[model samples]
Target: DACETRVPLVLCGNKVDLRDCGGRRGGVASEAGERLARDTGATYFETSCKNGDGVVDALIQLARQMVTTEDVAVQTSALRVCAADQKRPCCGGGGRKDV
Candidate 1:
């Protein structure tokens, strides 16, 4: 499956703090990161590991969604299994097993 089809994605651009010190020209780093996020339908964050900018915030956001969505998926799967096991021959035509 494509990354965009997934429920949650975080796009992080590291080493933002080095731009000025390394003499890198333009705001291309941030712009390119945002463009990639937009194209992939994911959240974008610019961070400097040296200074810890936006790192914690981005990780927390992703973690929060992961925990919540995983719980919901587990519950849904359990429900599907229970429903499938409850199937009876008289409940449907031809006595086909529930999927």
Candidate 2:
């Protein structure tokens, strides 16, 4: 059966290291990212590819959200059950039953 699911969201601001380079302004502020995240109901993260900051943290948070989501749990359970059923022999017989 098809079901509706609310997927978790994450807003990532990349290249945060650039913001600190030579005192030159870079991308949007962290506060702006946070505000957008709040408005969109998503988790916010700032990552720098050069320094590898917050990259793992963001991935971890996203993974946590995905595993903890209700719909994912339900779907996983259903798939397990289906797999178990598929393992059962047809006509309630295991292998070829001797007549």
Candidate 3:
């Protein structure tokens, strides 16, 4: 499903520490990755497999966004239900409930 849906992709270039020490350049393909991310309106991150750089932060940020989005969805649904109930006479009182 994810392979078919091409929205909200996250491109992570890992193992940066091994690149320079092994005669390989880190982020060499960063531009290409960035271009792809930009084209798809996705996020790009460079991480080091050895030292764990940017890993926690990236995951935390993603989690935070997910939580925020979920919260918004919950609130929106609650509001919709409240509005619908208010429009109906047999579904409890029309007044808002105290939280």
Candidate 4:
């Protein structure tokens, strides 16, 4: 639940490539998947790992949802945190200064 509150979530229905090849019924319908996504407050994706379809698109969509212009605006609105002894910034070259 903590992760849900802190991060954007995507509902992916993988293995779409096998929906028609074997002697098996198709998976959930697109309408059903969309309804599920609406109910869960998450983006839905029908991906096929076999042919690499919808994989990159889903990843890009999730990333865009997580990193938004609003978040950047809020971050830039706040005053920069300055360490007492540090010359540059809080996380600016702190670990790589010795390297």
Top candidate, metric TM-score: 1
Candidate 3 residue-wise lDDT, 1-99, digit = tens: 224332334667777676677676665367777887688776777777679987886677667766766676677779989998778866475676889
- List, residue by residue over 1-99, the lDDT tens digit for candidate 4: 223244577888777777787677655567778899988888999988878988898999999987874476456545344333445755765566554
When 2 and 4 are scored with TM-score, the better candidate is 2
Between 1 and 3, whose TM-score is larger?
1
Query: What are the clashing pairs of model 2?
Result: none
The lDDT ranking, best first, is 2, 1, 4, 3
Worst 10 residues of 2 by lDDT: 1-10
Residue 1 local lDDT, model 1: 19
> Which regions of candidate 3 deviate over 4 angstroms?
1-9, 25-28, 90-99
Q: What is the C-alpha RMSD of each candidate to the true structure, in Å?
A: 6.1, 6.0, 7.6, 9.7
C-alpha TM-scores of all predictions: 0.67, 0.65, 0.66, 0.59
Residues 1-99 of candidate 1 have per-residue lDDT tens digits of 133235878899888777787576533388889999999877899887789998998999899878887887787779989898778445566666659
Candidate 2, residue 58: lDDT: 91
Candidate 4 RMSD to the real structure? 9.7
How does model 2 score by TM-score? 0.65
TM-score of 3: 0.66
Error of 1 at 62 (Å): 1.6
Q: Sorted by TM-score, highest first, which candidate order results?
A: 1, 3, 2, 4
Q: Candidate 1 versus the native: TM-score?
A: 0.67
